[model samples]
Target chain A: MAINKNSNGYIIIYTVVMVVIVGALLAFLATSLKGKQDANVLNEQKVSIMKAFGEADANFDGVVTMGRINGGEFTVVEKADQQAVFELLGNRKALGEATDNLPIFQMEKDGVVKYVLPIVGKGLWGDIWGYVSLQQTEDNIIITGIVMDHAGETPGLGAEIATAKVQDMFAGKALYDATGAFAVRMQKGGAKNEHQVDAITGGTKTCDGVNAMLETSIGKYESFLRGAEAEVEADTAAAEECTCGECCEEEIVEPINEEE
Target chain B: MKLSKNFTNPLAANNPVIVQILGICSALAVTVKLEPALVMGLSVTFVTAFSNLVMSLLRNGLPSRIRIIVQLVVIATLVIVVDQFLRAYMYDVSKQLSVYVGLIITNCIVMGRVEAFALGNKPWDSFVDGVANGLGYAFILVLVAFFREFFGSGSLLGFKILGDWYTPNALMLFPPMALIIIGCIIWVHRSINKDLQEK
Candidate 1:
């Protein structure tokens, strides 16, 4: 076979044609898979939140439903009075925005309304975010669930932080002391108290990062919490009628002020 | 046409990594984990075979002056197709493979086979040659990964093949081990096949 000595123009044309063909093909494939990719990400978020809350049968399949939280919707209630509903927040994608106007869920079960605050922070290799439901008093809080993910961390070490055993330790752990200061810490050696979490053996840096993240991330919500508490107090004082035992006791002494 | 010489030559005698010293970077990076190594090997095999076939088909029409450019364009196109297929169907594996999948474009074995064999041979022969060379590359990778994953983490493809008593050596997962293993493989392969010795 005689080898054809082709001109430079022919080579350039061939290269351009090949580039266009391949580029077009890849573009089509990427467009087709974009939906599936987004769904996978959403599913992963749900699975992380469920795992953090120690919920059973949490599959990372990205179908949104009322029963499943999936980082999309969540119910918040006050710790003081579990019966009161504070708020119901939906469409959580807006919660991660830079705006100060957070999507807060409020509901009234008994009489008090509580504020549900969402927190986001960075883990060792990726992002770790969670939602903390606080009572109107802003004293006691419950970690509804946490979602942790990593871009690329050492598997079995840093990645293990996403597992159930590590995340479950934060379920009822109080973020503040009686003095109302952030005292939440991950115990490096081992957790001595119920509030402390045991660190993974080889994930010391990751553990410390989680601790620092929670502190800084949760600290931002302090103002919103204080505002909610103040609202609750004002509501109680403004009520004309009181059906509670304390209010009934005050009713009996109403005539004594007139004699004085 | 005799098939034995074409098939066996690449497996050991003209092994790409040891003898030809091509495509060593991926062998080191992906070998740390068996799963990724397997995926990378399969991907290389697919890319090499098809690229060679395509190159062989166009060899007659390909201008001598731009042959190298044409070969690269063909190989790169195949690599992109493989990458897209992996991403679409096997998203998790694709993520784990990461940039290594894209790096397939630079893997020397594909380009070398195209220039050396595909450009000069018929399409059928080029395809076979591509497969043989890809298998040869994969053979070395699997061997290196077997030892690396076995001793590095006391696991095979993430399964605990070795019991708890066998303490894993962390150094095995490092890239240096791949170099040493490839060197040892070369030493053993050369010792057994005296004809492969450099003049």
Candidate 2:
């Protein structure tokens, strides 16, 4: 039983059959794994947000409150509506010119409250995005932590932004200088002030992208930040005034009671 | 005894990386860190072994004219499957490996083995040969990665091994360092093996 192995008909049929089988197998695997893969991405987003808050292991649901800021009005999203925050952040760039209504996550730890802001921007190669958490102090806002990730930056050069050593420089840096300008940036050469951090040596374009991203992304929430700041100051002032008045009244009442 | 030779020969005598010079591209690219190198090794092993076995099983089919094309389709399918699985279960490593995982489709070792051995061999024997050659390539990758991570970053598998005072050799972090290390390994390998040296 001898059949020509190199016949055109046989080759064509073999190619078609092989292509069909392989295509079917790959499609089936991709569809079945889509759920698990998407879950992984969602969990990674949560972890990045948590990392930006400096509580890498903390539970996301228990510690954070989600909100959105639009036209200086803040709307809190309930626990069930948390997916809205992620969706908005994912669509931050798509909203482009209409950058309002950006998502914000609030968490308090060790009596200090911080706001986690999702930032998106373009690098030299592709989209670069991350979570940046700013801590509220008595006078100014300081960066508590940051977690950056890139889509496609040159490895060991522009991609260094994802490394902790680079991200650590942003911590404790003030968003605005004493004059109240949005001064935080990745300074070229070397950083000499509190508002600036050293830019990646070889990643100038990517660093520039980061600088612009920080300014623009953080700028979108300026009104919300100011409003929150004022509220905190008023609350503290009221508490101080109450303590002072209570002390004076207690002393006066005590002396009157003694005379009686 | 012949079955065992198919498994053991590529581990040293017919080493795919140092001897056959196959898959040197990925060997150089992913060996910057020990973790990725190890993962890359395991990944290549999976692709090669499966492709070899599959090709060998199909070798008897009457289609010599399109065997190369068939081999390519099989290898590509396996690589994609590996990439998808990595993205699903090991997202971090997947990100770290980045484009190298996809590039595994082009690694010459998979096709070389399928063409050179698998086409004329039994399925189980071809599979063993594929695994052996894969480990051979991985052995060199891990070796290069060890020196690179140890000296370039003062770390092993992401754990810092050197003290703060120990400044790392920045040269080792670059790609050229991997080549130099490979050269050194080849030199050492030839010195011991003796038979690998040219006349």
Candidate 3:
């Protein structure tokens, strides 16, 4: 018996069967791939953090230390529990009520210690975020490198923030001004001082977002930054105060060579 | 001989982008860079080939009243699966292509092949036609993307070819430039193939 191809009953049955088969296929694929996708995302975060630290292809296993700021105190996170820190960054939002725990990563290379902070903020269209690498000098903290990304900023305009040209400008720029305010920003006309960088030509709003992102996110680590800065200053001051101490003893040997 | 004609016809004489003027939207959108455009091309090829094969195999049993809906369901499912696979395996390219992979469901080439050729042909013949049409579209996409990426960003496939002294043409990075390049391709293609020109 030939089936009636145009009958309503056949259409309904065909539709139901087709829908069920397609749905099951897609559901099965999504479930099977979820683990791999999650791993990719986590690896991407780790790579971004490494890139921001200016160490591409660097091993992340034992080199970087993960931590969080809780109750105005910084605490190191164990390696096993570090997955939660990455998840926290993935779910971060702009202007969400400041959470008790703020994620931070620390890495040391060539005797210089760098702090990598995960920051989230709003751009013209959607969420903007990045890892900012900061180093402490004798008096202040300066950005060493940064790697930014956006959910949906306009390409070539606001999205320029993600480009190396823009991010490279953050390097050597101090996070604090002489007045000691969180003064780093994207200057509109052109940056005139160390605290600013030139903003994208047509990306004023997104630059403003970056400015806010840097201020609020980095500002949350003020206590940690101040402590780090004080330690550096104290070390230099103590070195200068020594006349016959370890630092001066080395200098004295150098002076004797000059005299000879 | 018939299969060979089916395969070769779409490559140039009945090209999907230039001759048929189909799939211009994505051609413009993804052609700003070579990498994403190549991925888009391959993804479209995958969707069109499989969709054609499936539709052709099911053509006899498919009810005439719900043909379009069935085609859509098939195309949508294929596109989603491709998207999931991309996210899992090629995360960076998946991020770059972003929504265009999902938008393959709306690409006319996939549906057009299934409707115009697949439903009436043998599965093997339909599959060849699908691949040819997809590649025909891919050929134009890669050609346009080469010029765009080279001039627009002074690079090819993310590698900088021009030195610092060379300034990139900003206009080439936009969608309008893709259109202009495609228009130029059509002009050159028609000049060579006289019969394709409208009287």
Candidate 4:
């Protein structure tokens, strides 16, 4: 007898077989490519960090993950040395979960050690994130380099945040003033000082996202930087106190401001 | 000559976008950039051809009641595989293309061919028809993207052709303008093919 192609049993069997096969294949493909996709994200982050650290034309080489630091106004940890991506969590001071740990990448250029901080926040449509690198100055943290990128920003409008043209506006913009307030921003109209950059022609919302991300991400690093500054001062103090063998003393320096 | 007709008919007389107006949504979305338009066109070409071949191979066994589901499963699997391969190998392009690649599963053109041509034709012939229809769809998509990208973006394949002095027309980048362009193409196509005009 000729088989009834429309039989219920036949339809069910065909569906089950097809679903299992398709499900397995897609699962296998996603799992197999997960490693490569993770690597790509890491490499892209590296490029952004590197670009933020040196001249756009600089031939700077090498990228080191350095380590992760858990920081906020209330807590301080130095050189935590956590290396796993799964274990690493950098909260966008404004959006990330309260328990997230911040990841930092470090690179050296022209004898200057630059620390790169990755910032993530919202764009008009989706997530916008970037790397902001700071050069430790004698007194404060100076914004040396920045690279901004987005997930679903309008290609010609908000998406301009990712382009070198927009990111270049961030070069030399200081995240903190002489008194150390997070003052750097992506602002509209004409910029009067080093803290501002002109917003994209049609990307005002995205610019706002970039500004907010910097504020939250950079503010979280305030204490850590202050610690570094005190460490530098302590080094100076120790050297001066060690004049000859008669007097040698290590001065106690407050690592961070514990009061609000 | 008879075999060639299957390939040539869709390019002009039986065009998918202009004549049938089946896949206009993608034609509008992907045409904003020539680079994406080219990639989307090729991807659709692959989906259409391969899905048609597979459906035709199983046509005799396809349960009449469950044919649509079977066709959808086949088309969806193909689209996912293509999307994954793209993400792994052509990540930037894949990102730009984004959800549209998955939307190919819903692109009526793929479904239309499976139901219309593949359901009835020999496997080889169905494959040819699918490719022919894809090229037909692509021809219109690339045409729309060319005008949109050139006038709307002042560029071709992401390369700047217009001088710095040129101001891009934002209207061309908008989706409605794509409809207008497709409308004009349909008008021109119908004008040339007098037989296509309704009495």
> Which prediction has the highest TM-score against the true structure?
3
Residue by residue across A175-205, what tens digits does model 1's lDDT show? 6665566777778899887568788766777
lDDT of 2 by residue, A130-197 (tens): 99999766556889999998876755567889999999999999876766678899988989887899
Top DockQ: which candidate number?
Answer: 3
Tens digit per residue, CA lDDT, model 2, B15-123: 8988788898887788878999999999999999999999999989838878888889999999999999999999999988888999999999999999998999999
Candidate 1 CAPRI classification by DockQ? acceptable
Local accuracy of candidate 4 as per-residue lDDT tens digits, A58-86: 44333343645565322323334332432
Where is model 1 more than 4 Å wrong at Cα? A1-5, A59-147, A154-260, B64-68
TM-score of decoy 2: 0.86
Q: Could you tell me the TM-score of candidate 3?
A: 0.87
Q: Using lDDT as the measure, what is the rank order of every candidate, best first?
A: 3, 2, 4, 1
TM-scores of the candidates in the order shown: 0.68, 0.86, 0.87, 0.83
Clashes of each: 8, 0, 0, 1
User: How accurate locally is residue A34 in candidate 3, as Cα lDDT from 0 to 100?
Assistant: 98
Name the runs in model 3 displaced over 4 angstroms: A92-98, A123-126, A152-160, A201-208, A226-260
Q: Is candidate 2 or candidate 4 better by lDDT?
A: 2
Q: Per-residue lDDT for B96-182 in model 1, tens only?
A: 776788889999999999999888898988898889899998888988998998998788988888897998787786678899999
The DockQ-based CAPRI class assigned to model 3 is medium
Report the lDDT of model 2 for residue B199: 97
lDDT of 4 by residue, B3-33 (tens): 6999899889988888888998888788888
Q: Candidate 2, residue A2: CA error in Å? A: 5.7
True-vs-predicted CA distance for residue B124, candidate 1, Å: 1.9
- CA lDDT of each prediction against the hidden true structure: 0.67, 0.84, 0.87, 0.77
Residue range A45-115, candidate 3, lDDT tens digits: 99999999999789787899898887657799997888777777777653244666778889988899999
